[model samples]
Target: MTKNNALGTNVIAQIGILVHDIEKTSQKYADFFGVEKPEWSLTDTLERAKTEFEGNPTDARAKLAFFDMGSLQLELIEPDQNPSTWRKHLDEHGEGPHHIAFFIEGMKEKIAIMESKQMPLLQKGEYTGGRYAYMDTFKDLKIIMELLENDN
Candidate 1:
C-alpha cells in the first residue's frame, strides 16, 4: 500500500486517561508528577460541543486536567453520564489510560484514510477551535488512537 500524504508527519502528543473523578485523579497525578499545581486542560470547561457516538450524533461532557510533561501532555478525563468514549471505557474497563493522541493538520483527509483502513470512528466531538475523534483500533493496537485538529 502506498503511503498517503493525508496524515502528514505527526507525533504522539498526549496520553489520555479515563477516570471516575477528575478532581481526585488530578491530585493523584499531581502528586505522582511532584507538581504542586497542575494546569487545567482545555476541556476543563465545556466548549460548545457537537459530539457523536458510534457514528451517530450524541452528547457528552468531561472534566479534564492537563499536565505538560515536556513535549508530551498527560490528560485525565472524567466523563459525565452522557454516552461517550470515556463513559464507555469506564463502564467496560474501569479507570485507566484510554488513548494516545496525535495532533494533525489535514484532519478531514486523515480521517478518511483511517476509516478507509477499517479503523472505524468510535467517538467524535467538536470544541472551541477544532475537533477530536477516537478511532477504535483495539483489534490491532489494543488501544485507541485519537486525532486532534486544533485552531490554536
Candidate 2:
C-alpha cells in the first residue's frame, strides 16, 4: 500500500453545491459566509472544458463559477434545466453541499488505496479526459467526497 501523508494531501480542493437557481444559491453563500458573489458562465466557455473534467456531456448544461476561500475553491454549480443532477440532489436534499473534491495526481492509485482500506465507492468513472471517483465517508455526511485526477 502507498503511504499518503494526511497533512501532505490537499483534502478539499473544491466544494460543490447543486442548485436550481444560481442567483439564489450565490446570494445565500454570499450572505451566510460573506463570500463574494461568483461569476457565472454558460455552455460557451464550458465547451472547452467538455474534455477536461470528469463530468459527462450532460453536465454541459451546468452553469459554473468559483470563489476562493484561502487555497481552496468554492464552486457553485447550477444545472441548466430540470431533471438534472442538481435538480435531483436539490429535490432530495434541497440546495446544500453536494460534494467535496480532492485533486490528486494518480486517481487509480488513490482508488486502489481506498479500496484496500475497505472503503466502498459510491461511484467511479472516467470522463472528460479525466478520472474521478466518489466515496461516502461516515454516517450523516450525506455528501460524497470526490477524488479527481486531471491529465494536467
Candidate 3:
C-alpha cells in the first residue's frame, strides 16, 4: 500500500449505479453487452443486514443486480422507499452513478482514515460473508466510496 493511500489499494472492485427500475436497466445492460440478464434480488433482511444509516439503525433495503465486466463489477441498485444512502442518492440525484467500491482489509482503520480526510461514514451493513461501508466522499471524489471487507 502506498503511504498516501487511505484505502490501502488502488483497485476499484465495483462501480454502483442507482436506478429507478432495476429490471429495465438490467435488461438494457444485458442487451447492450449481449449477455443474459442477471437476476435482481432484494438485499438481505434488516435483521440479517444489521444496517445502519447516518449513525442510526435503519430498515432500508434495495434490490440489486451485478454484471461482472473483466476486472470490475457493475452494480445496479433500486432502493425501496426507505431512508438509506441508496434511497437518498436515487431521490436526490435521480438515477445515476452512486459509488465506487474497493475491497479492503481493516475496515475500521480504513473508515477512520477516510473520516480523517473529511469523508464521514454514510451507511454500513453486513452481508452473508462480508460487511460494507459507504463513505461520503462525493464532494471531493464526485462519488461515494464503498469499502468491502470479506471474512473468508
Candidate 4:
C-alpha cells in the first residue's frame, strides 16, 4: 500500500483495469469468472462527458464495462484516441490493472486532500449525477487512485 493519509486504503470501492480491447477482455473476464460478458458502452454523445487532463481540458473518451463483485465492482476501460490518463497508461505500460477507486461522499474535499498530499490530478470526467477523477498514485503504490462521487 501507499503512504497513509486521512483517506487511507480502506475506502477503495473497486479495481479498474486498462484493457486493449474492452469486448475481448470483458469476455475473458466473464469466462474466467464463469459468467456472461457484461455489456459495454462508449461515452454517449448526448450525455457525453467532459474531461480534464493534468488540469487542462481534454477530449478523452473510453468504452467501459462494469461487473458486480459482491461488495465491490470490477471495471474495464478501453480508452479512445483522445488524450487521456487511460490512454497514457495504455501507451506507456500496455493493458493491465491501472487504478483502484474510492467512492467518496464529498469528492471535492477528498480531492483537495489528495492535492494537498501532492497527488496531482491526472484525469477527470463529469456525467449526469456523478463525477470521477484519477490522481497520481503510481509513484507510491504503482497504481492510480480514482475518486468517485455520485449524487444519489
Best by lDDT: 3
Return the lDDT, model 4, position 83: 82
User: What TM-score does each of the candidates earn?
Assistant: 0.87, 0.62, 0.98, 0.89
lDDT of 3 by residue, 13-48 (tens): 999999999999999999999999999988887899
Compose the digit string of candidate 4's lDDT tens values, residues 17-70.
Answer: 999889999999999999889999886432367678877777778899999988
Query: lDDT for model 1, on a 0 to 1 scale?
Result: 0.81
The number of clashing residue pairs in model 1 is: 0
Q: How accurate is candidate 2 locally (lDDT)?
A: 0.64
For model 2, how does the per-residue alpha-carbon lDDT over 1-152 read when each residue is reduced to its tens digit? 23564213756798887776888778877888876787786533334443222233533356877777887888787765533445556677877787888887777677667656655555554546686666654344556677878787
Q: Name the lDDT value of residue 40 in candidate 1.
A: 54
* Backbone collision tally, model 2: 0
Whole-model lDDT, model 4: 0.84
- Ten consecutive residues with minimal summed lDDT in candidate 1? 39-48
- Determine which window of 10 residues in candidate 3 has minimal summed lDDT: 1-10
* By lDDT: ranked, best first: 3, 4, 1, 2
Candidate 3 displacement at residue 68 in angstroms: 0.3
Pairs of colliding residues, candidate 3? none
Give residue 144's lDDT in candidate 2 (0 to 100): 68
The top-ranked prediction according to TM-score is 3
Q: 1-152, model 1: which lDDT tens digit per residue?
A: 23654456557899999888777878887888798656555342234666788877665777788888999998888888877888889999999989999888777777888888888889888777888989988888899999999996
Instruction: Report the poorest 10 consecutive residues by lDDT, candidate 2.
Output: 51-60
